[model samples]
Target chain A: MVEIKNLTKRYGGNVALHGISFDIKDHEILGFLGPNGAGKSTTMNIIAGYLPSTSGTVTINGFDITEQAADAKRCIGYLPEIPPVYPDMRVEEYLTFCAGIKGIKRPDVKPQVESAMERLHITDMRRRLIRNLSKGYKQRVGFAQALLGNPKILILDEPTVGLDPAQVSEVRALIKELGKDHAVIFSSHILAEVSAVCERVVIITKGEIRAIDTIEHLERSMTANTLLNLTVEGEKDTALRILKDIRGIKEIKYLNAADGRVSCQLTLEDESVRNEIMSALMANGCNIAEMSMAKLDLEQVFLKLTAQKEKRSSLQDLLDETPDVSGEAPQDAANDTTE
Target chain B: MFALYKKELQAFFYSPFAYVLTALFMLIFSFGFITSIANMDSNTLKFSFPEFFYNNFFYFIFIIPLLTMRSFADERRGGTEVLLYSSPLSVTQIVLAKFLAIVTVFLFMIVLSLFFPIYAACTGKVIWSALICAYAGFFLWGLVCIALGMLLSSLTGNAIIAAIIGEIVMEGLLFLDQVAGSRLVDAYPHLNSVVTWFSMQRRFVYFSQGMFRLEDLVFFLSVTALVLCWNVLSIEKRRYSHA
Candidate 1:
């Protein structure tokens, strides 16, 4: 298990990671979702012990990362934003060195090296020089390097950033497999990848965490109203009148009535009212064509949350004389959480 | 620490860097050897082989920087430091491993230079005892140079900048000896005394004569350890986000 409490990092006058806190339990694969320069790498660097925090503490298992550094670092395998590899080294030589520096025992080093190469499907490219390999192959070698010693926690930053579609899926599948035992925390801008592999996600933007929840729960939180696209092959006025009789149909926009095929958007007060709207349309003389709920995907939810945060911060900037009013977003999140 | 040391050693030997550096060192040493042989008339039948190494310490001020210019600067510029920094190894271990690797390579070059004394002994009457002492002094001087280069490398992420700074500082120390006796410092006897005390070239004079003073050994070893400790501290400062 990894725990972070009120972690803060400041670079000169600029704040990179504010007083944000979160934790990952054993056997949980948590996805870190954020935009560019959204403090994803900052948080990962702090957790990996590559950088120190200005305040707060990060504890892995029972060992604090700053206090009990060696033991805390012994449990983590970190792959930084850029794969930290020696282009001059061969794949096998590099992995062997990684296992060694990761402090694996002498007798266990060879076996663990082979196991990591096999796990990442780089067994065939073992003897090749890292500089001569393609981008995808280099990435696989980086992943293989991180897998050495089989630490209990894996922190991968943008694991699938540069890869072909097939390689991307292959690495994602490997992450899923590793997550079966290791407590994996991976960050990516790709929403689909997170949805496919992560059980929960921590969404961050502007150095603050916007939300942290399972995909299902986050999807359910924005369910106060839903847009239903209704297409009918009937008279437009009859369909409009039928939709009016349905309760909780708060807003309706008639898209088109060309060729007697009318399209309309019905904003229901709640998702459960969709069946009644369909029943009313059918009870009247209307040939219903299609009805589907306009659900919010992870991408939409991320954009909405981040966009709202940006608007709030920009407003604070206008109000405050100090230009570094961007620091106010965390206070806004704190207020929202308290309420 | 052993793992880091082994990896650093492998990195040097596995690349063409080791071969290239050795060739450069041998090339410069050969120039010094030929000059010494030319200066020694044939009828004399005697030449101090290690004298060429002591005479060419100025060239080493440039050559040693090339050998250690990439120690820490390359790791930072290439972003490979993330691996060592995030690993279980301490900063002291990382710096010491790299320092040891470069020293090992320097020792290899020293071994290769032994051919000069061996060849001279075969051709003429060489002072074997003096040769032994000269070799010891040469190696200690080389260690000091390596430590200075490593410390400069840790001060910046650019290898070229590190090398340039090393060259300047090394050349400054070499020039300090000449300046100590110059007419300009005659007015300030205290400053001249201080500069003369720190001049590495004047200190090498006693070693070149096969004289081993305890103070000299302590000076060389202490300087090496002090510079290396400073190197470790400089690199360790980078582990903090804001420091």
Candidate 2:
């Protein structure tokens, strides 16, 4: 229902979004995953027609956002990072106003407002001033405002930021329910929230899209490397040396050591490498107390995808360009003695 | 658009803001009325409502910025601008709705001030034609001030700062009237003509003398429209260059 093409946003000299493109199909729940300052809100704001993109276009249900803003905006229900609520207005009064602005018929406004309040379970707080409500209730009121027009596309920017666990779950459930008929896109830095509620996730960092795939697809892709968790009762150095000697071990990271027992995580080249490591540890008299092959979950996949894009420094590039500097030889000799 | 307009009106009337401002407006008008009556000429026993409006313009100008200060600034500070921007309404519609809402409040104040003229008419002689002309002229001048005040509100995102700057700008306009009449400016015919052309008080004087010139009407309305257009453009500019 929404097609965002080559969307770029620049704030003076700084780029907030760099030609990011994505689409939301009807009845789909697309999760926008990113850390803070990752342009998640910027992208959402552009899609909602609040902020104009520096370049590119957002087409909602075939209406260009800039060319046909009124029609395009009529198809969207946006709840910004802040609730965008008037605290002085009553809950019911506020929702009715929302419905009216959404171009709902005069007679239909009351029913739409009532149904929205009912859905958010805020019917009881209808008469109360929004300022008097708690944060969670205020968020629900914002969410309820989005549901007023029954728009096909819903863009929620961190809807669960300030809510308690139960309220978060309730909002998740509401989003899941809304996804049945609407193209719902919600953003968050919380991996578990995305995994729990979203079928497909878009991982973004540093104004770039790191990965976009289903949760299962991303986790399965990362599991191909095969992570092994090994806890051995032996000298920490000896166990580490033995694990290092294994041919299939790509990388080994120490978890912890206590009471002469060392636990370490090993990234293996294949699943069969576990047997070779087990036999090699047994031959060295390092008793393997416990061993398990760990599959990379959504969190690990997210970390790997986001962390792999670390920026390269200019110093490293300079060194790579001129590798044979005579001044580096004496420094290397001095560093060896310090080590 | 109507929904937003209604909400803006509720923001004024539902709070104590409209009532307090209306009370203050009536107080100023009654004070002007009583003083004009007390200082009436003993030979003629005449009290001109037009002169009362003219003398009261300075005090009445102070309340306008207060009425318009919260129109756009509060929406921005409270993060509700997003709601308005994302709605199906255009920028022009939003600006026009807010402008009309403040104009409505100003009209309410003007209508309430009419109680003085009506009370004076019951007790003594009153000139209805000149009085109505003065009322029209005052309302037109108020339209220009209201539009200018709303423009300031849009430019500054803080209500208090918008009000302060609005007061300064209004005072500057009144000061321009003084400068236009000064001997220094009158010495140069070219500069005097330009200053008098932009001087709203001089045009208002023609209205107070019971002369409804089309030139002054068009000037007041066109200036108000120009300011309202500026308000709309500034809002759109902020959204474009929004950080």
The candidate maximizing TM-score is 2
Score residue A253 of candidate 2 by CA lDDT.
77
Tens-digit lDDT string for candidate 1 (B1-243): 877788777888887888888888888888888878778867964667556666788886788898889998988888888899889988888888888989999999989988887887787677877788888888888899999999998888999999999999888887887898788987799998888777777677778788888888898999999998988777767666433
lDDT of 2 by residue, A49-165 (tens): 999999998999999999999999999999999998999999999999999888999999999999999999999999999999999999999999988889999999999999999
Work out candidate 1's RMSD over C-alphas.
Answer: 8.2
lDDT winner among the candidates? 2
Q: What is the lDDT, from 0 to 100, of the residue B209 in candidate 2?
A: 92
Local error of candidate 1 at B26, Å?
1.7
Clashing residue pairs in candidate 2 (N, C-alpha, C atoms within 3 angstroms): none
DockQ of model 1 vs. true complex:
0.65
Residue A117 C-alpha lDDT in model 1: 85
Chain A TM-scores for all candidates read: 0.76, 0.75
